[model samples]
Target: MSSASSSSVSAAAPASDWSAARIAEAAAEIVAGEQLPAIVQAGHPVLRTRAVAFDGQLDAELLDALLTIMRRTMHEAPGVGLAAPQIGLPLRLAVLEDTWAADEEIAHTRSREPLPFVAMVNPAYIPVGDGRAEFFEGCLSVRGYTAVVRRPDRVEARWSAPDGAARAAEFRGWQARIVQHETDHLGGTLYLDKAEARSLCANEEYSARWAQSTPEHAARALGF
Candidate 1:
């Protein structure tokens, strides 16, 4: 699949250094702002660069503030998840939560489930069992379109929690998909890298023709 190589949005990034005090100061500036920080979009260098793994870059109090804003930004974006690079911070931090309407049929077909908010640092995942689920996915960075991406249906997710404690758990269904997408950000990967080019469609087209819970119809028509 050919990846789009264009961008129409950008952000003014804070300085990138390995200093804890500098990171804390920049993060504090963000927390102090009234407006939501700009979400860096496609073609931004930070989004394509590997993120620095969290390693006590910020003290506990500032770390909490950073996580809080990340969480709030995700909710405000009305997206299920967001990554640090998407906000112009090249740190291996991400926030994820899944919420949806109570449509029984859609919920069952999409394997949709609600997930509580999580802040993961230096996260990674491995497939639990091999089987694939293909669905239309989109990203805030790659705004205005979505494509069919096949992903593992289950995974063993692991990461460090805000309290600097190690955490691991099994996730399946849509929750697993969320984990894969967010974790990919840490490695400088986007869903489009794994998407079927034939299934790429603008958001309007998706609403008009391919909004099904499953991408079976899209896959067949697109011949992926």
Candidate 2:
């Protein structure tokens, strides 16, 4: 598989230069309504740093405020999911929502459905089987591109709700994809790490060239 070229943002700075202060500044811009926080690019130190567990540190007021910000940020970025590290917060937290239901073709291809807004803390997932599904993926943190990533088709996740209640459920298809992707962020992992490098491309190029392709087609055409 050929490795995809890095986006300008991901290559703009060395990994070491992305300090917490920089992340804080970026985050403050969003919280203060100055501007939406720039999504931390893939090579930024924050994206690669392992996130800390929220545990019991977050009180009701803090958690509520954080959730509001995160949901707004996710919607502003127009992404289905957002993790804490993506906005410079190294906490095991993520928000996701997919208001639109998949069309018949897409539903048949990936079994995706609309998802309500969700906030998860300290989320972890386990693969259900050897079954795997591959699809094009993009990230707010990575920016400007997408790549084919093969992931477990189903997963059982354990997480905490805002009220400190334990939650566990099995997710399949695109739902599983969203959970796995967000949880990976907490562990300092990115889909690029597991992507078919040759299949990566700029968003425009992907839409023009491979948007209609399926996992089997991608494997045949891109050698993933």
Q: Give me the runs in candidate 1 sitting further than 4 Å from their true place.
A: 1-22
Give the lowest summed-lDDT range of ten residues in model 2.
Answer: 1-10
Candidate 1 residue pairs in backbone clash: none
TM-score of each: 0.89, 0.84
lDDT of 1 at 163: 93
Candidate 2 lDDT score at position 216:
68
Candidate 2: C-alpha lDDT: 0.73
Q: List the residue pairs that clash in candidate 2.
A: 2-198
- Across 73-170, the per-residue lDDT of candidate 2 in tens digits comes to 88877788888888877767888787654557867787687778888988888889899988888888888888888889989988888888998888
lDDT of model 2 at residue 3? 13
Candidate lDDT scores, in order, read: 0.78, 0.73
lDDT per residue for candidate 1 within 52-156, as digits (tens), equals: 778887888888988889888887777888888788787788898876464677679768888888899888888877878888888888888999888888888
User: Model 2 misses residue 53 by how many Å?
Assistant: 0.7
